[model samples]
Target chain A: MLKRVHFPASLLPYLLVAPQVFITLVFFIWPASQAVYQSLLVQDAFGLSTEFVWFENFEYLWGNQQYRDTFGRTIFFSVAVAFLSMSFALILAGFADRVIRGSTVYRTLLIWPYAVAPVLAGALWLFMFNPTLGIIPFILDAFGRDWNHYLNGGEAMFLVIIAAAWKQVAYNFLFYLAAMQSIPRSIIEAAAIDGAGPVRRFVTVIFPLISPTTFFLLVVNAVYAFFETFGIIHAVTQGGPANATTTLVYKVYNDGFIGLDLGGSAAQSVILMILVIAMTVVQFRFIEKRVQY
Target chain B: MVEKRPGFTIVAHIVLIFGVALVALPVWITFVGASHDGARMLQAPIPMWPGDQFFENLRQTFFGRGLDGSRTAPVWMMMFNSLVMAMMIAVGKIAISLLSAFAIVYFKFPFRMGFFWLIFITLMLPVEVRILPTFEVVADLGMLNSYWGLTVPLIASATATFMFRQVFLTIPDEMLESARIDGAGPMRFFWDILLPLSRTNIAALFVILFIYGWNQYLWPLLITTDPDMMTIVVSIKQMLEASEQTPQWNIIMMTALLAMVPPIFVVIAMQKLFVKGLTETDK
Candidate 1:
């Protein structure tokens, strides 16, 4: 990746990379190694000493019903969030791609929510669903279906999913729209000439063509709902209503910081690290494929 | 667009309009909710239009005492903390990324790829995944409750460095050669040539990183237990906690509004650069 006529080796280059390397070492690399090493070390009952018990925390977590439920719940939450946000964004981008007029205006209006922090999104959604004074419950009462996320686990999960998905729609929409814009106009025109309807053309041509973006957004959204939705889960649910909304990231925080189960928390952290590494590998592989063409 | 179908165009327009409305609805609700007084918000039939108590709520949020029992920082002070944290994170990330990218692209050195891979690995290790150890590290360093504590650990950006490396590689090699023939030093060449060329990239990355830094929640939430160190975003959670004791919807919504406005304004104002930075950095 380096240039051909680059400068010769010197201490200046070493000095230049020193700051980033030092920060990365102190913050990322060191902490990650700690998570891995500590994952294998179990503390004694007195909370004074630790024993090097490899993989016991992970095995205990695997056998624990609550941890297994949290793992399943996190998968469900991430998939629901990814599906909802991506589909909504795709529909909007498909429509926006059709209109020549004021598309930029629509993009501007649609994408500002991306700037709203996840926690703030949770706050806004929580206010509107505040049960006693909330507008959503008021409307649901008119429909004869009760809505109280505070007591209902399913409803709490639903609330976190909606808030998390709503924040992600703008990001997904921008990518889908950009992918759509980059597609050649003549391909669509050719499909129209072949007697294909608009929806059929999109199904057969446009959607397949943008599968790269779809796949990329899939990994990105999964990474987001896995880790970044910590804010949403923290603010709105606190992984509450009987722990229905505790994703892996939230669990890592809850167990590590609040629970003080060091080995268990570190095991969870190592698991999450493996997850991130897997996702990153998939992403880089996809990028490599894209670069080849 | 392929055919002159006005019906299809109208439907597209309708769908886009509805999508836009759906996206904007929560924000509009927040705005309306913020404008009303606390009692008005707690009652039924929250007003559809803006309320007359906007300035009152703003004043109360900025200068009022604690809401009933719980202590909270003044809204202005929390936002200022957020501002300071955000600026430091954005500038720090760009500065470190630029120097590292310049070195990687323009120089041949020992352990170059080793250092590059090390920086690149930070992308996979988000603070959420390793919260305990990182917090322990920060606490051990006695950096808790400070701006350095808030921003420093979050500043090692793999994406920014990668993006800048890509940018520098695209620049002609002749520039460096000519600068060298003119007796320009490495730092001088970097300062005079590379910085000017990558100005837009730096600005674009600033927009993105500023938002990234501003929106941080879990990091600041755990580290800054002190009231004075609370950021605006984190303060929303505290305000919500206080709402259990005293339901001040007006002030809470106003603070949420205040917490979110600056980043939203940056995105809107720098829409082009934001789009460019986002697509490039993610790629």
Candidate 2:
């Protein structure tokens, strides 16, 4: 990784890396190890006694109906989010890639949501979907349909997914557009000359060619929906309507902080950490494979 | 330019326009919501067009107590807190990452790879997963309700460091040798040569990280229990929770606008750099 002509081994490099190393140890490594350790020890509700029970927390999570439901719900949430946002972005990117003129303007208009914080995005969506006074509900009322994310569990999941997916569309779109643009024009030109229509070419040529970007975005978006959308879940529903929207990450925060259930929360945290590690490994492995393409 | 298919081009434009409009609709509604008076906002079928109370809402949100019942720090104070937190995080991450990446690429340090892998571990352990213990550590250190608590724990960024490392690796080794030939120390070369060369990258990364820092939700929410120390982003949660009774749509929408505006401005104004930064860091 280093240059051939590197500086000799010295104390200066130690000083240079000290800050990052220190922070990593203190904030990241320590907390992570503590989570693992805490997961093994269950404390009484009164915070009176602690006992080391090996894998009991994990077993408890596996057996608990709500935790299991949250796990399934999280996978469903990520899949739905990844599918919705990616397809939408891919469609927009597919179209945007065709327009020779005003593509930059289109991109500028489309990607500003990337800068919006997820909580605020949640707030905005919550505002729009507010049952009594929201504009969307008003529109839905005219259509003879009800829309309120608050009291309905399915609707709560749907709303959070939309907000989470909404913010992610910009990121996916940028990547998809970049990936689309990087394809050599001659291939598309030859396909067009061979009488492949735009849809046909996109399906047969562009889509497969950009599978690497698609995969990358999939992993990125899944990790995003898993961890980063905590704000959206927290602000929008608080894992509400009886924990219908409780992702694993949100459950960790809720159990630990709000519910004050340390063992359960730490166990959930450890599970989420394992999931992250797996996702990171998968990302790196796929990234290595993508380099071959 | 693949082929001049007029029908397809028309269709493409329509799709893009529709997509843009869909993406822009929420912000447009929020903007409209922020413009009307409180009573108007409370009414059903809130006006789709902007009303004339924009400055009045802005005045109330910015200068006065933010909402009716919530005793929050003034909107400007929270925005300033967000600004300070964002700047610190961006600057802090860039500074330390530049140092560590420089050391890893330029110096033959012992455990160089060890340090690199150690930093990489942080990527897998996000604050959400380790919230309780991290919060306990911060509380044990008495950093809660402080700027350091808000910014520092979250600043150990593996992505930024890796990006800089990649940037440094692309630089010719001859630059380093030539600087050594001139008898300049490593820090001097870093300050005078490397910093200037990577200025654009630094700026690009700044745009991305600034948004990241500004948009932090859970950490700031957990750490800054004191309302005075709350970030604008975190304050939205507070406003939403507190306003469960007699919700003030106008003021809350205004605050959401306040929270999103600066970062949105950065992304749009620095669109090129933002794109560059995003592609590089994530890769």
Candidate 3:
């Protein structure tokens, strides 16, 4: 990773690297270690005394129906978000890739939402789906359906998923368009000369060529849904409507900061750390494989 | 060009128009909300068209008391806090990452890999996972309710460091050799050659990092309990909570618009750099 010819060993290098190493140690390593330590210790309700309880926190989490439900809910949320946003982006990119004109204009219009923050995204969707005056619910009311996400758990989950996916569509669109644009046009022309229609060509050739991009986007989207959607969930639902919308990350925040359950929160944090490490590993592994292409 | 079917081309344009409409729906709604008075916003089936209250709402939100009966800072102060946080994070991350990447690539130092791995480990431990303990650490250091608490912990970015490392690696070895032959020291060479070479990448990364910093919600939420230190993004949540009582849709929507405009403008204005930085760094 370094150059063949390098500077001689000196204290200057240490000084140069000190700021980054120091910040990482203090902010990242120390807190992570503290979470691991605290996961083994249970505190009383009054926050006065603590007892060492190894694996009890994890065991308790495994047995708790609510925690398990939250686990399932989080996976469902992530998968739905990935599927919805990716499919929509795939369609848009497919069309945008076909156009010989106005592609840049279409791309510019489609990609601005990537700049929006997750919480602001949440706010925007929340306003659009606001029960009394929201435009969407108003339209749904015309169909003789009552719409209230605040009171309904399913609707709350749906709203959060839509907001999360909406913000992510621009990102996925950019990647998909790039991947599509990189495919050699002569291959598609050959497919066309074989009497294959546009749909057939796309299904048989274009889709297979972009499989790597699909895989890469899958992992990235899962990570986005896992960690980055916290703002969307927090702003939109706050894990409300009987905790139906509380994903694993939101649960950690709710239990520790709001519920004051130190051991449980720490345990959740440890679990999340494992999840992140796994995702990062998968991402890097795929990235290395992608270099071959 | 591939054989074009008139029907297929028509279908493509129609689908694209629909997609754009779907994506722009929420922003349009927010804009329409911001452009109306409080009474108009409270009415059922809120107006889809813009109103003439845009300037009035801007005045009330920026200079006037933000939301009725809510004891929060004015919109301008929160925007100022957000700007400060974003600038500090972008500049701090670029500065430290440049220095460390330079050190790692150019110098043969003791524990070099150890330090590199330490920085890499931050990628796996996002602030969300270690919220409670990190909050405690910051509180213990008396950094709560301050700009440092808002920005410093978030500034140590592994992605930026790695990107700069990749940029520095691609520079030919002859440049460094020539600089050395001219009797230029390491820092001088870095300042004159390396920094100049990486200027475009730096600017591109600044756009991405600035948006990231400005868009932060949770870290600032945990640290900045004082209303005066509240960022516009965080204050939107507070106003949402207060809306349960007062329901000031106009002011809240106005605040949301104000919060999002700066970053959206940056992305649209620097579209090429944004796309380049995004595809480069994420891979």
- Candidate RMSDs in Å, in order, are 1.2, 1.1, 1.0
Query: What TM-score against the true fold does each predicted structure earn?
Result: 0.98, 0.99, 0.99
Off by over 4 Å in 1: A291-293
Model 3 interface Cα RMSD in Å: 0.8
DockQ of each candidate relative to the true complex: 0.86, 0.88, 0.85
Tens-place lDDT per residue, model 1, B1-283, is 8988899999999999888888888888888988998889888766668899989888998877536565778888889999999999999999999999999998989888999999989989988889999998999999999999999999998999999999998899889999999999899999999999999999999999999999999899988988899899998888898898789888889999998999999999999999998999987
RMSD of 3: 1.0
Arranged by DockQ with the best first, the candidates are: 2, 1, 3
Ranking by TM-score: 3, 2, 1
Which is the leading candidate under DockQ? 2
lDDT of 3 by residue, A32-87 (tens): 99999999999999999999999999999999999999999999999999999999
Q: What is the C-alpha lDDT of each candidate?
A: 0.91, 0.93, 0.93
The regions of model 3 sitting more than 4 angstroms off are A291-293
lDDT of 2 by residue, A1-293 (tens): 98899888889999999999999999999999999999999999899999999999999999999888889999999999999999999999999999999999999999999999999999999998999888888889999999877789999999999999999999999999999999999999999999999999999999999999999999999999999999999999999988899999988888888899999999999988899999999999998888322
Candidate 2: RMSD over Cα atoms?
Answer: 1.1
Stretch of 10 with least lDDT, candidate 2 chain B: B63-72
**Candidate order by lDDT, highest to lowest?**
3, 2, 1
